[model samples]
Target chain A: MEQQNELSFDTLVIGGGIAGSEAAINLANLNYKVILVEKDLSLGGKMIHLSKVFPTLDCAACITTPKVSETIRHPNITIYTYSEVKNIVKVSEKKFTATLVKKPRYVNEDLCTGCQECEDKCPVVVKDQFQYDLVGRKAVYVPFSIANPRVVNIDIENCILCGLCEKVCPVDAIDFTQEDVEIPLTVKSVIIATGFELFDPTQILRYGFGKFKNVVTAMQMERQLVPTRPYNSVLRPKDGKMPDNIAYILCTGSRDETVGNPICSQICCMYSVKQAQLLLGALPMADVSIYCMDIRAFGKGFCEFYQQAVGMGVEFHKGRVAKITEKENGNLILRYEDIEEGKIKEVEHDLVVLSIGVLPNPDAKLLFDSPVIESDEFNYVKQTDELLCPPDTNIKGVFVAGTSSGPMDIPDSILSAGAASACSANYIRN
Target chain B: METKKIKTIDIIKEKRTVSAEAKQNLKEYNKIKKLILKSLESEAKTIPQIAAETELPLDVVTFYLMTLRRYGSIETGEIDDMDEYFSYKLKK
Candidate 1:
């Protein structure tokens, strides 16, 4: 038999998002050897890319970076970035075994210094996905400035292999022969904190998201408002013009049967309102409008935040946007039904933002073989008792946290992670 | 220099060709890039002026200029008289 190169840990946290980081830190502080596995090159998930979070107007990176740094530097926590858990099998009542595959970054982690020499020399420029394709990144790139590891990974598929990057590296860190490394992990407990993916707006043809240049998603606009924004200022993508009027379409893909997602995304409305306020600050003389079926400000101080936007001269149209059409000058014409006035109205705006919904990422379900991990009707990880024990999955000693269980805001995600960590710790002690 | 460095260079040279689609795309990009560089050879120009000179779409011109700026081939200068768009110049 081949030797199983097995490493053991007290607990395994399957993601490095806000919830996963919180859970890992809590577990590590308890003096438990915890392993945090993240598929991305960075520790902070989508939160780091955001400009500012809702209700607090706090810089999203400001809140996330400290936690990320803490998680990475924690003595009891070991991090695996650019890695995935292939299969996780329940070994016993209290033990689980997992197969982790670490993808090659083609750069030696120990030797590399985070310098831009290789990035500057590379001639191939591709869409920067971290910036939501609003800008170009070289084939060899660190995902963003605040990426935790702050090391560049070569996009092997897109790399022309002209040896420019290899030649420019001060330290001989570029290794083309690097291959994926498989790691077997034995753990006493497992926490699934794999987060959610945003709903793609292209499926809703009526919104004209892909066809219309000025029609951007909420996340894209969030990037534009950030300090490391793709552009120097917020200009409409179609003609590079400073927009005067901007409209927001709330609930783009959520609560709509057509897209097959019927539940409320629980964050789109508040985020849209937040973006509207930020846009007004960015463009002082610009007009902002929001069209929504209903203002579902269900969280603490959320209603006050919505009202504050209204107080700041933001036009809140109680309506449902039916369709959007592009004008000759890259402006947008929105056809919506005004619910309060009971009239169908057509309005023009230079820029429109589609507040896309959150969808459950079902990737964690594929990592288990026996005692098949259960998913609810909406495809989120099933919680046996949401009120009593919110983080317990169907399998014993295994837990689910954050958006892996369902759609939740950042505060809820953190609370969920705490619960999962506590429950796992208790389970381990018993 | 070293044998290991020479081997890496040889591997890169052997495997450096782009795909058909990428090659065609690069060819088109180089064509537009050359035109923009030629137009900016005499003086720095705003995005709209470059668009007009190159007869390219404003979005296309802006994307290319931004890409060039990112790769250190171009740099931004003073804003236009209207204070709307910044002028771009070739990096010396």
Candidate 2:
């Protein structure tokens, strides 16, 4: 691979999600030269895709957009989207050498104006994963309308290579010949803020997430409620009808040893309630119900939020979903053992959202030498002292932040990032 | 010595060769998409109406309709009051 220009920073913050972005901004404010690397084409991370934050029901985009813009505008912070840390080597006690790979956006970043001319001419269409595949995106297009940097990336896997995009490029920024380049950096400290991935509900065969039309994941439902939603309104994926009956199956992939994740995904309960509240507002007449083994309203003001949801007439049923079968009319029949009734009861709904769990980024260890770092039983970065030094990993000068440590909501993730920044800054200063 | 830049696209393509099962699935998807287009040929139809006419699952029909809309082959017309699904017609 061709080597890009060598770069060095005081600190390297991996994963440009909210946690990483916040950490970078914090470090930058401290006058530390920082580098923020994101594997995705954009920097907002999973938080940007969410419709609203729980407890407050604040617009998620409104909260995430400013962080993204701040990270981009920070003079001391060098943001590299569509990039990853390939390898990290300890050079000295508090110094490390890292190799960063820049994945090709297939467009010249410096010259390319964020124009959709090339996208307008591209012919191939495929499922937009950014929108949870609810809508289709061009093979050559920007990630989203509000994407940070607003640069177009060619989905080379789906691109037909008709060269129409190149022909229409006014600035000739479309580069089919672009390649991944490796750039080396030396930093005094490193923060592994690589976030978590949503648990795939298809693994729980009983839920019928991939098979049934009306069955969707909570993340997919969140996408439907966003301002940039694929459909004009929150309509059922099956038949595009405004669903009168909606159901949320909490702990779909969490708290189940069968799926290998037994811990309660802390955000699932609150997020399900938040989505239920939003759904009630969007579909005032729709009957929204949540089936869960327990509602963990443990967070601050979370109980009040739960009460608010109940006040809005959202049903909270304590039960364990046994199975979900699709009816002929595309409605879903959910069979669960109602704790109150002590019997298996069936409820029919037009749409069912699976509140999937969160899992550590499986590739966390791959970014560094495994022998240098240790992962807990759940594969999250092992913190040395959860009570005192929550961000300190097994390796000195390297800290773990956000969901990289464990499942956490936005506020906790941000607080974890703050702890990581402090640890990294202290290490660098020493 | 000149170093060759590694194209990530080639790496992606090398790893993503279509499987026979995937090809079969694609064929099935194209068939369903064709059926949806044919249904829209006569008149604008809501998603549920199309699902009933085509005998395809509602979610499956909705997926095809969205794909068609993205391709600029379908456009939304009037909305049905009963179910609130828009009547989708073939874009002229």
Candidate 3:
């Protein structure tokens, strides 16, 4: 990537996800030259996908939007989306040289206006990933509503060789032939905020998500509930109508080692509570029950939020669902031993939502050397300790915050964002 | 004078992590009590002396001095202004 001799910055942040974004902002605010790199085409990270953050039923987009806007406006900060940090060389104890690959977005970034006609007209149809496949979009699309560097993309695979997009482009921005460009940079310190991904539910066949249309992941719920599109309205996928009762199964992929994640995801319980609360807040008629082994409300005001959910009439029975089978006539039969009752019980629900867990992004290991940062048994980044050094990673000058380090709610994500910023600034200062 | 021993920190995290009992009123004021008790025969030392000896949260140390005065544990009388430094003294 260094073949270009690009301008160097004081701090370089990998992963334009929440932690990295926060770190970049922190350093920039402290008057340090900062560069934030994101593999995706835009910023806001995973914090954007959540419907509402816990402790405050505040809209997720509302929290992330201002941060993205601020990052764009920071004079000391440079943002590189659709980019990857290829390599890093420790240049003495004070400087680090990095090789970065800036992937071609195919659209002339400079000329293509954010007018979004390219997104509207692009004939190639692909699953709208932001909506978690409940929706579809033309391959050339914006990542989400609150995306930074608001730009459109052209999906190379599904383009249909349609010159329609190229013909309609006012700036001749469509460049299907553009190849990957390598750039090199030198920075004083590098921070890794590569965020985690949702543990794919398909791996847990016993959950029956693939076997049934009614069963869905928590992420899918957030996407559907987001205002970007029409919410499916909590209806059963098969019948398209509200049901008498809804079941939310917490930690479907968390705190269970057989599925390969034994650590508590840390945010599932609270977000599940928020989901239940949101249901009660919006519908006021839906009966909700959450099945889980234990609730971990470790964040500020989190335990209060959990209690608030309980006060709102959520039945939080402690149990791991043993068998969930789709019953005929559009219902699910849940058979599990409720730890509180100490007896096996059966319940039927119209829709079942699995509070799925977060996993390290698949490409996380590829971009860095082994053990540069300490990871938990589940491969999530480990916080150095509970206090004093909240977002610090093992490597010097590289700090982590948000779910990139561990599972957290929105306020904690913002807190970590501020903490990461402080860490980055400290590194730059010293 | 609320100088909680090191053992109290562990007791908070391990014993009552989910309970309000974790926050307790300690036995003595942090360092002023230490200073006043140590200075039973004389007046209290300067702010710099207390700060130098106690690595405490800044606001916490201030709060204790204010509380001591409220409870008649220390009497406040300003000393000669040595340019920018202020000193406090123990009550009889």
Candidate that would win on lDDT = 1
Q: Roughly what TM-score does model 3 have, to 2 decimal places?
A: 0.77
Which regions of candidate 1 fall more than 4 Å away from where they truly are? A1-4, B1-6, B9-17, B77-86
Q: What TM-score does candidate 1 reach? A: 0.95
> Which docking band does candidate 2 fall into?
acceptable
Each model's chain A TM-score: 0.98, 0.99, 0.92
What digit string (tens of lDDT, one per residue) describes model 1 on residues A102-163? 88888887788889688888777778899888778888998899999889999877776677
TM-scores of the models, in the given order? 0.95, 0.92, 0.77
Show what share of the native A-B interface contacts model 1 retains: 0.22
Q: Which ten residues in a row have the lowest lDDT in candidate 3 chain B?
A: B18-27
Positional deviation of residue A354's Cα in model 2 after best superposition, in angstroms: 0.4
Give lDDT tens digits, candidate 3, residues A1-430.
1246576998888877666767788788778898888898888888777777778778877877787888878999988899888667666655777778888776778887767777666534444677665534565776666677877777655444445666677777776656677887888877777877887888878779867767878887776566664232444444334554789999888888898888878788888888888877655767899999989988788889989989999998888898888876657998889898799999998778999988776555455552355676657676676488876766676677667766665566767878777766776667
Listed for every candidate in order, the interface RMSD values in angstroms are 2.3, 4.6, 34.0
Lowest summed lDDT across 10 adjacent residues in model 2 chain A is found at A156-165
Return the TM-score for candidate 2, rounded to 2 decimals. Answer: 0.92
The 0-to-1 C-alpha lDDT of every candidate, in the order given, reads 0.88, 0.87, 0.69
Q: Candidates ranked by lDDT, best first? A: 1, 2, 3
Sort the candidates on DockQ, descending order: 1, 2, 3
lDDT (Cα, tens digit) per residue for candidate 2, span A1-430: 6797779899999998899998999999999999999999999999999999999999999999999999999999998999889779887887788899988888998878889898888766677898898877787888887899898998776665556777788887877667789999888989999999899988989889888878999999999999888876788887798888999999987888998998878999999999999998888889999999999999999999999999999999999999999987789999999999898899898899999999889778887753367899988899999999999998898999899999999999999999999999999887
